[model samples]
Target: MGAMDVVLVHGIFDNGAVFRRLADALADAGHRCWVPALKPADGRTGIEDLVAKLHAYIDRHLGSDAEVALVGFRMGCIVSRYYLQMRDGVRRTKALNVATGPDPEVGDAPKPTLSTSGC
Candidate 1:
């Protein structure tokens, strides 16, 4: 299969700069990648702010037809979910990787139908 576009979201104490090597590797592999910094006050800022920034960056950098895979490290996972749920942007996103964090229990929570096909 062809490579999918991806956006890297950083966690606390970082600003997407940490994903530089990963981004470069992805780019070199022919997949479009972006590492936009979404700074918060070291967990002081709300997730909404970060989510909004994520949406803005995607809208401005990626076109409307772009479908990307979101890879989040630590708190960035929370930010990714908010953007996917609140903005209903899941349809435009291919996958979400919630790494370096605890996995959430979305089975009981009210959200979109997440199945193994996309898993």
Candidate 2:
């Protein structure tokens, strides 16, 4: 497949730097990658705020009509979900890959998995 746009969202207490390796690999594979640092990574600012930031970032950098695949880690999964489900992001999202972390309900995190749904 031709190069596709991919946005990597880091986990809590982390920044875009955390995706350096993955971004490099994706770049080598001919995919365009964008790792945006969501501030207040601790989530004190709330997921909705982060989602809004994510939406604005995508719109500014990739444009509102561009299609993208989202890779979210830890708390980023929550933010991504909000963006996709609550913000009408599913319309432009090509895929959703999640790297889960500790969960209060599950008691333990599940293995990392990539979940994708057609837009």
Clash number for every model?
A: 0, 0
Query: TM-scores for all candidates?
Result: 0.82, 0.85
Query: On residues 81-116, what C-alpha lDDT tens digit does candidate 1 reach at each position?
Result: 777888676878887776775457643323433321
Lowest summed lDDT over 10 consecutive residues: which window, candidate 2? 104-113
lDDT of each: 0.75, 0.82
RMSD of 1: 3.1
Model 2 TM-score, 2 decimals: 0.85
- When summed lDDT is taken over every stretch of 10 residues in candidate 1, the lowest stretch is 110-119
Candidate 2 lDDT, 1-119, residue by residue in tens: 46789999889999998899999999999899998889989999888889999999999999999999998899888788778877788888878877874453563333323356421
The candidate that wins on TM-score is: 2
Model number with the top lDDT = 2
**Model 1 lDDT at residue 93:** 82
